[model samples]
Target chain A: MTTSDSSPTVRTPLYNLHVELGAKMVPFAGYDMPVSYPLGVLGEHNHTREKAGLFDVSHMGQAYLTGPDHDTCAAALEALVPGAVLTLGKGRIRYTQLLNSDGGIIDDLMVTRLVDDEDDGRLFLVVNAGCKHGDYAHIAAHLPAGIHLEPIEDRALVALQGPGAAEMFATICPEASEMGFMTAIRTDINGVDCWISRCGYTGEDGYEISVPEPQAEEFARLLLAHEAVEAIGLGARDSLRLESGLCLYGHDIDTTTSPVEADLMFSIAKRRREEGGFPGYGRVRSEIENGPKRIRVGIVPQTRAPAREGTEIQSNGETVGVITSGGFGPTYGGPIAMGYVSPEFSSPGCEVDLIVRGKTMPAKIAAMPFVEQRYYRKPKV
Target chain B: MSNIKYTEDHEYIRVDGDIATVGITDFAQSQLGDVVFVELPEVGASFEQGEDAAVVESVKAASEIYAPVSGEIVEVNTALEDEPTGVNSDPMGNGWFMKIKLSKASELDELMDEDAYKALVASQS
Candidate 1:
């Protein structure tokens, strides 16, 4: 967790804002990102569960894919991912992953089907910051004629997430209150054109606003001025997502990890699962039918000591798995982790030992989202 | 406080005759941020100067507390095992890690005094 200093890193639009709020800035994914603020990581984590915490996620890549119509555009994207991009409804967002030919995840992203008829063929994508350039190039290279993938470079992405987020949004963006989970809208905020999504990495009911670069700081300040919102940094962001059982791109899911093995089969559309047109369809289909050899699962250490990343997991004294992301869960009440283990040991209550500093600590395979997910979903009648 | 000596690693040693109370400095606790857990050495354990004696875990990382001088652990702070926030709240007082019976009282001469430690901390920022 040392700050990178050898090479210069770029800064986000909120760099000055973070500094103004006394943040501990560290180089992350080629950007000078804020890791924590004066509120502290633990305080920020708890705050987001009780109140809205604003996070600057501008480093993520935002792009637009355009074609003759939804059919042509979906076909191009479907070739790379297993998600049902073709069936996505207007204004609805679908979470998917970019796959290599080997059934490995290149990156996980959010794809939104635009609402306006003029933007009929357009699909908006938000990808991981570190893999954005590669993802864009890969998508562009694979696109058929008449389709275009344009990277939106001048935008700052921010999230306001928590239990109180909806109440806060109801006062400002009244339309947001009626939004279902994973829905988005393009609207003007104080005359500033923005894209708002009723989705966030933290499992709480919240929204992500994409503000243009010039007005980003002003927009961020506007939210910070609200009593319900407090500025959060990357430290809490990691813990929040970890507690939510969500995957972090490089840490939890990498190019070598497939969706099935990563326990992200939900993202694979049922139609795609049956039709199988994606790049790694063969392996994905086989894994779906036969089950993956290793399965990702949640880990809860029995002791106060956390089993951090790279901690070896042993069952009956034989090594069975390794932790990918582990830390103190401020909201979950104790140490929580997620990692891959042999199939037989992947069930909840399956006992395991975490070897930390040569000492074996007892743990169990617990169910994910250590804290139950609180996403706001519209009632189905 | 006048009898206290400091280490470059941000440990404080308060000497009373041949016995000393050892804990992380307030500066170190602040730098480490939130403290989640603390692993203390057993009372009978013996350690050499610079050897790992205890472990402290923050939310993001695990750090070792080295033995500031060659000594035998006389007492361990067991309260921290159940409530580690003491490391952040009163790190210099109730958050003390251990009490050691020095094998060689002369080893204290090698540690930084109050003025020198303050200067070292000042230089860092």
Candidate 2:
């Protein structure tokens, strides 16, 4: 998204590092972000799947919620989202969406239950860069009297992702090696105080490190010094997430889209479903049972031409839906897209036509993650 | 040797008699990042100057390639269909998108020469 010229662009602690590496910087979410490095988007993308790629995600909002105990804090957050936050185990993370009263997603975020006894009644949150301001306001307004939400503005976030990510992170903090998917721990990295999570948006086995702003650059440099780690930009991040079939905040899932319609029903915990008290619970539950009018699905075009965002989708000469995110999948070696279509037309192998620049290109509804997810989970005892 | 000319939109044309070969400039390809696919007009297709003639898609975004001059397409580079990266590796050679039988050879006078095109590129950056 383009920012108005009047508003000064914000820079993360690693901004200078990106410039030193000769990255192509562009405006994104009111910040001057690195879109790609000198290695190019395709090269950077392939490197991440084969090695570890470090991404500066400092633009995201990190916050803490404190209350009397776990129950009080969980109830405060539960009032804003439909996820089973109250039942989240200590040191564990849950993926959920903040919804408006109408059941539309305000933002998708990661909620972690802290383990420290001193912060026994606290929860940690990481929200999207663009929606963080509005999300923080919403949380603060609905917060109960005892519970307080504090935005951690002095911290910077970075994601080390791909197959080699865990190994690289292990070399820095060995204790992180034992963490399973959707888990978090607070540990020091080379003397830098940090909060590390064994989770990422790329659908790969990775870690997201939250370091204080002062030590962020030094910490990033330490990770980049590792042979398996290379600097990645937003360009590769988008492609990697697309290949993983994960939803982008404003694109694939937005305020106009519900979790069920966006195919994110898995995030709705069984307990929340049975006892519905969350926002848009009635509409979401109804859609979960009877199905929504339209649902998001993976689209594979039969031609070399890519059907980009806003491309219209039609079936048998009648328009059914539109593409929300589409691009040439470097990993897929061809064009891949995701879009919304009527429930009757969302089944895999169903043929549809993508009206690209007024030409109808043959496409089919396909199962997502177009690539297999490689998340690492500990074996159950 | 053919006479070469350039357009402000970063397209280049190599003219030999009334036939002209067209492709995007090196500057355009660099700005486009990695070229993954190219949608070209078929042989014998007709287009007017500034009309949308082709689409070049990179891993990052899709861009429109416009007709540099009015003409009828005489040949298309089928090689790019398989090796789209040719646009990034050899934009001026095998990356040529199409050849057109110019409807008016005088249209070449309106295009920029090598020196003028280089200056335009310099001003842009």
* Cα TM-score of candidate 1: 0.98
Chain B vs. true chain B: TM-score per candidate = 0.97, 0.97
Q: Model 1: per-residue lDDT, tens digit, A7-54?
A: 889899999999999999889888899889998999999999999999
Per-candidate TM vs. native? Answer: 0.98, 0.98
- Candidate 2: the clashing residue pairs are none
**Chain B TM-score of candidate number 1:** 0.97
Q: Which 10 successive residues of model 2 chain A have the least lDDT summed?
A: A1-10
lDDT per residue as tens, model 1, B1-125: 34999999999999988889999999999888899999999999999999999999997689999999999999999999999999999999999999999998899999999999999999975
Give the backbone clash total of model 1: 0
Off by over 4 Å in 1: A1-5
Q: Distance from true position, residue A351, model 1, in Å? A: 0.7
Candidate 2: tens digits of C-alpha lDDT, residues A1-381: 323264677999999999999999887888889999988999988999988899999999999988999998998899889889999999989999999988999999999999677778899999999899999999999998999999999999999999999888888889988999999889877789989899997778999999999999999999999999899999999899998999998989999899999999899889898888888998998998899989999999999998988999998899999999999888888899999999999999999999999898999999999888899989899
Q: lDDT per model, in order?
A: 0.92, 0.92
| Candidate 2, CAPRI quality class derived from DockQ | high
A352 Cα displacement, candidate 2 (Å): 0.8
